[model samples]
Target: DVKVTQSSRYLVKRTGEKVFLECVQDMDHENMFWYRQDPGLGLRLIYFSYDVKMKEKGDIPEGYSVSREKKERFSLILESASTNQTSMYLCASTLPAGLAGAETQYFGPGTRLLVL
Candidate 1:
């Protein structure tokens, strides 16, 4: 079975603190993504990696960065926490598009971050 895991389900951080949100997938998928959803703003893609050690910046990569040191693991880092940055962060993995199997993504439970 395919499983995606995040380091934390919920996180509370003070302003200016560095925060790390980690994600891992059991399947050896080629693509991993990080996204943040805010009220009214909807889902915004932050970053993604198509291959191991290869990373790409997504729609909003201003305050967020990512790492894919291993095939199963991807880490999202918050340079400095802020109230404006508080949102539900999500991680997902998918098979390469247009493959034999479904290209639908399997997502982690998500990390809800609150900056105080």
Candidate 2:
């Protein structure tokens, strides 16, 4: 089965601290994504990479960035963790181009962050 794993299932950080959230997929999928889920707001994309070394900013990429040095791994970086950044972050991957479907994504369990 296609699986995506996140670096942490839970994280606690102080305000202004830089945080790194890592994700790895074993399915060799070409598309990887990062999103933050807040209560009632649903999932908001942070960044996504379509190909190795290529990345694109998503809807809510304001205080975040991403890196994709390898095809199976994608990393999300929080420049400065703020209280407002406290949310459940999800890492997901999908089949290569031309394969995305309504049920395309394979998501990690999620990493919940608490920024104090």
Candidate 3:
């Protein structure tokens, strides 16, 4: 079974501060994603990584960056936190596409970040 965990369940940051969101998967999934959930906007993908040291920009990649230094871990970095960037951040992991049930994503508990 795949299990995803986030480094924090809740975070409070000030404007212009750097925020780091960490995610880990236990199943060694090859694909990892970072998403931001906001009311009425649904989930917007921030970044995704398919392999170590390789990352792709998603729907809303502005002001955010990602790193995949290991097979089981992925990190999302907010260069300078802003009030508009405050949202519930979710991390998910899944197997590579084309396999059975490869679309199924295991999600973390989410980190609610409040930027002041």
Candidate 4:
């Protein structure tokens, strides 16, 4: 079975604190992504990695960064947390695109971050 897990289910942080959101997948997928979900803005991708140590910025990369040192883990880093950055952060993993089941992403439970 494919499983994705996040480091925390809910987190509270003050403004200007560095936040690290961790995600791990058991499937050994080749692609990993970090996204933030908001009420109206929907799911906006922050970053993605297709291979180890190779990351690509997504639509909303500002104030966000990602690290993929191993095949099973992906980390999303928020340099400095802010009120505007508070949201439900999600981590997902999937097979490389163009392959079977590539469109189906296994997602973590998500970490809801609140910046005070």
| TM per prediction | 0.94, 0.94, 0.96, 0.95
Per-residue lDDT of model 3, residues 23-93, tens digit only? 99999899999999999999999999999999999999999999999999999999999999989999999
**Model 2: lDDT of residue 100:** 52
Global lDDT of model 3: 0.95
- Distance from true position, residue 97, model 2, in Å? 3.9
Model 1 over residues 1-116: C-alpha lDDT tens digits? 89999999999999999999999999999999999999898889999999989999999999888889999999999999889999999999998988477588999999999999
Off by over 4 Å in 4: 99-102
Give the distance in Å from residue 99's predicted Cα in candidate 3 to where it truly belongs. 5.6
lDDT of 3 at 104: 84
| Backbone clash count, each prediction separately | 0, 0, 0, 0
lDDT of 2 by residue, 17-37 (tens): 999999999998889999999
lDDT, each prediction? 0.93, 0.93, 0.95, 0.94
Which one is best on TM-score? 3
Error of 1 at 26 (Å): 0.2
The runs of at least 3 residues in candidate 2 whose Cα sits more than 4 Å from the true structure, single-residue gaps closed, are 99-103
Q: Give per-residue CA lDDT, model 4, range 1-116, as digits (tens).
A: 89999999999999999999999999989999999999988899999999999999999999998899999999999999999999999999998878454578889999999999
State the local distance difference test value for candidate 2: 0.93
